[model samples]
Target: MAAYTQDAILLLGDSLAQGKFDRAGLADRLACVYVRKMDVINRGLGGYNTDWAIPVAEQVLAQQHEQHRVPRVQLLIIWTNFVHLVNMVRSPASAYYSPNTRVILITPPPVNTHQRTDRSFADTESYAEAVKEVGAQVSVPVADVWTEIWEAAGWDELACEQFLFDGLHLNAAGYEIVFNSIMKIIEERYPEIHYEKLQTVFPHWSEVNVNDPRPSLVKRRVPIV
Candidate 1:
């Protein structure tokens, strides 16, 4: 494993990491609990999948020196599934990434509308499985957002109706929940980043209202249009 003494988080992936929550911004809430030395960068692009992650990764490599034994510039929090690009980059994956990079793969959550009659559970499961499969190529840790919250009241579930202002995006509370889950995963699996105390990325975050709007649970299913 490449060891990086730097304090930073490089988030890359799809719109999910881009904060699809309404009521509570999942990534915003996450910034509070990092509780360590790190810089968080949200590089998630809407509509991106695994295939596209390659070029992005390549661009990142350009900024690095081709040398080992050096600290990494950032920690990779990739929330992508560019399956289209996988085949192109799979062989000699070393060409795509620098030795100084550490990776965390976040699986795509079930963005499909869940109706009692809709049978797309399998698709979410497949997305989760795809995350694991893709991670194998890069040898990175995969955060199975799909498995973590797939069964947990989706758009079809009454508890999740209001949770997602719309059918796919999460409300503030919804983002908050997912944010917490991500923190727990980082703490447990990625001990290197587990700073003993809360670390602040933004200097002004302290002045910001930490609790302007307290988190609340909403369980009303939005009617299907």
Candidate 2:
């Protein structure tokens, strides 16, 4: 197989971003959509709060300049706890600093106390709100995951459990909600980068003329404007 490099969509957060509950987490789901257009880099630090993520995020950005193989970061999605959301969004030096790169802040989903003893839905909601507020202040997109999942469950606490694996992490269904929410914002705000609108590397097999495949197989680069 031939090896190639493309721009990246960076996913930075905690366990949820790491896909602890669902191995095919946000990054995986996005990779399926972007296909060959971009690489989805999951820099999820399990059990990490925003304080730790700040320094790490800077390192990732700095290292990007040193590594030629590391594609430029086109989009950065930060899905951390409320405490970190503010710093991540407000700090101008983080990954979101680039004018060429877009950013999306994802608030954590509501937790079900019945199934998990560590977190509470009430606290999650508060944190989610802070994320939204920061996003507004920074003019960055914010995905109110807590609200989305809660409404999807018809605002029923017990019904909300369907979206979680252990009341803390998300299951497949829960991840779907997060994926859709993020995609919706991307479609609305960054339509140029939308996967559906992106051109594939090569033409479909049926579209290629066996006698002159190269002419049909190669596509010009689609600049992000």
Candidate 3:
């Protein structure tokens, strides 16, 4: 295993979060933007809801004792909906609590019942709203993806096909919205960790002196606000 040389932005959620097939998925976009600044770890599991996520989080998150060896989770982005999951990390009594870690809650995208039957439009909408409520209760930032996509779809359920591939999962267009929403949240809530504000772990090649390249290649700790 690679040594813990950088902090991480851990992403946890359901299929919407996993999105291994979508090149424009949230994880992919975040990885691209956060490269060299922070490692973006995707722990998104397909078909997993809040209930299934609880047990999984315990395993994925480092225990208090393991803090010294593991990369610190500086930012956590949860695309799942549930208060328990949020409290598990934010609550002072929880074992995984990290006071320095910032959290961002993301609402699920809108569902179009017409193209999909397993889920209902209203049900998904409720889940999205619940995420926002949890974010408010815990004082974490929320990426209100539901409302943003709904508006992008012109408030018409059927029109969501422009972004969604099967009225359920997102396409490149949909992922773009998710990526934009996340970037906006980061800009407003965690400006210090923003990609633009952070310096690369190693100096740019242009800064390296030809006769003394070893010193410029040394990795440096990134300052976080």
The TM-score values for the models, in the order shown, are 0.63, 0.84, 0.96
Q: List per-prediction Cα lDDT, in the order shown.
A: 0.55, 0.78, 0.86
Q: How many clashes in candidate 3? A: 0
Off by more than 4 A, model 2 = 1-4, 63-69, 81-97, 206-209, 212-220
Q: For residue 128, what is the lDDT in candidate 3?
A: 85
Residue-wise lDDT of candidate 2 within 1-225, one digit each (tens)? 534446778888998998964466888899998887888899989999878887787666634245445456678898864435444434566443355677888989888888887777688888888888878877888888899999998988778889998888898899999999999999999888888887665556798899988788775354783
TM-score computed on alpha carbons, candidate 1:
0.63
lDDT of 2: 0.78
TM-score-based ranking: 3, 2, 1
Clashing pairs in 3: none
Q: Which tens-of-lDDT digit does each residue in 158-183 have in candidate 1?
A: 45544456555566655656676666
Ranking by lDDT: 3, 2, 1
